[model samples]
Target: MSEHIIVRVAGVVEETAHVRTLRLEKLDGAPFTRFRSGAHIDVVGPTGVLRQYSLASSPLESSSITIAVKLEPEGRGGSAAMHEVKVGDHLKIGKPRNLLSIADDADQHLLVAGGIGVTPLLAMAYELYTWGADFELHYFTRSREEMAFAELLSERVEFRDRVHLHVGVPRDQQPEILEGIAGRLTSASHVYTCGPVGFMDQVRAVLAPTVGDDHVHIEHFEAAEIDTSGDSTFTVELDTGESYEVPADKSILAVLEENGIEVFKSCEEGVCGSCVSGLLEGTAEHRDNCLTESDRADQIALCVSRAASDRLVIELY
Candidate 1:
């Protein structure tokens, strides 16, 4: 089930050429829920599109919640709709939920933010600063004009020294720059990165050679790419004894929703863990990046994962 609260856009600030910061407050004039540094909320826009955004506001501030958006013309129109919103316009947003956090035992934190992915890490940096924890933020943008919150962050006495800017130029020389940045991480440092798939993959590959896998944490700015040419039809057996034939072109989530089974999902590309269902029987050809070997009960992400067997049984109840 989806829970929503009504919020009014209190103000909007153009952080950069392409990014805008939306400051929101409860319509009731009451304090909003407290959220962790890396938490995100789902916004149901005026266009009837539901999209998730990482909170960029400090958790210590209860007056309002804020999110930064980068205008992506080719995206599903959520950002464009958000850009259209003006102060005083009301919006329905979900309560904050956290899927990322800092480790208490880490001696140092390395936050790497690429392009618009700086939203969550900005909040993390605030918390780290508040706690007086040792950390550094590497902010990457195509150019100085494209750096979100550059002035706001750079002017802050607390963030000025810790935030490093890495501007992009001559676009053809990214691989070398990315490699040098990724190679700086140390064993005692816990790394958190949010960026493009290729950016994260490059970081992981570089870290894998020396750093422990557990020390490197990442979140996807977009879904990872995968091939679907081999997809075939399959049967899904529900606990109620009813069955549904999922066509190769349709996802299990889509077939179930068409059959009146409401599944709560976000990031339909399967990067988010919202639609992961426990499996009672049958192996899943898991194609999602959210699941790991530690995931219990042979769970599967219905959005992308398909049946390894001809028929699969699921426990959705």
Candidate 2:
């Protein structure tokens, strides 16, 4: 398990009918380390189930870290449990981890968010405002009432004239709006987006032609459904020279743990990048959503990725 810090909910804001923002302060009264703009933390709920939440607060704010949770009645119980939490409730949370961040070399950043996916992009907007960087944020929602951080995006001087909120846009009409957004993209513009998989897929399909695949980035709250019907057994060798055969039905991380080899992991679905290990040898069939193409060259997410070659050599930190 990863190290966790005890925190008390200091404040709560009802962002929408289904979304609540919790502001947490360390129980020990220590200031939180400044996180990257698009970082997320693993929140262990009252039900003892761990879920990752993106930090919506400004990275410069160390006194408190804020996470917005949208209740999902039909889905897992973690969000439902979080919705029941009140101010003063104590909880354990992992250190902030970042898989998405503002690119340093972009001439201008285009931030696109869908529904509850606005959390991470909100942080990026705050950071971009602080740096006086050129950027624009587009948040799309079914209605204004469902949009989180509406006031912050609309009323804040930092976001004035830069944040565009699209409300009540029909699904069929979204493509036209996205096309307009894509038309404004310059060769140097880098696009970053977070949302439901379908919404993100549409964004990628529409924008990739404008910015190219290399300059387009995405942040996934959950991994896409993957079909592993054709997976074959493979051999994995650790730096210590121990070898293990990973079956098609088992994950590399599970095989390692079953063999008593300890590996730090969270969000085994490969959305958190927690089980990423150094690939000393062999090619990997990358399957994780969090790793960039460059990262895949020498690293692998042990939780979901499989070896492309018959044998793979991994280094555990």
Per-residue CA lDDT of candidate 2, range 15-37, in tens? 99999999999987799999999
Q: How accurate is candidate 2 locally (lDDT)?
A: 0.91
Q: What TM-score quantifies how close candidate 1 is to the native fold?
A: 0.89
Regions of candidate 1 where Cα sits further than 4 Å from its true position: 169-185, 238-243
lDDT by residue for model 1 (1-317), tens? 27888899999999877789999999878997678898888888889788888899889899998998888899899889988899999988887876667777777888878888888898889899999999888777888888888887779865799988888733345556645755665677777778777776666666645456777777765777778899999999887788999999999999999999988788787766778888878878887866654563478889988987998888673
Candidate 2 Cα misplacement greater than 4 A, ranges:
none
What pairs collide in candidate 1? none
Alpha carbon deviation, residue 109, candidate 1 (Å): 1.1
User: How many clashing pairs per prediction, in order?
Assistant: 0, 0
Structural similarity to truth (TM-score) of each candidate: 0.89, 0.95
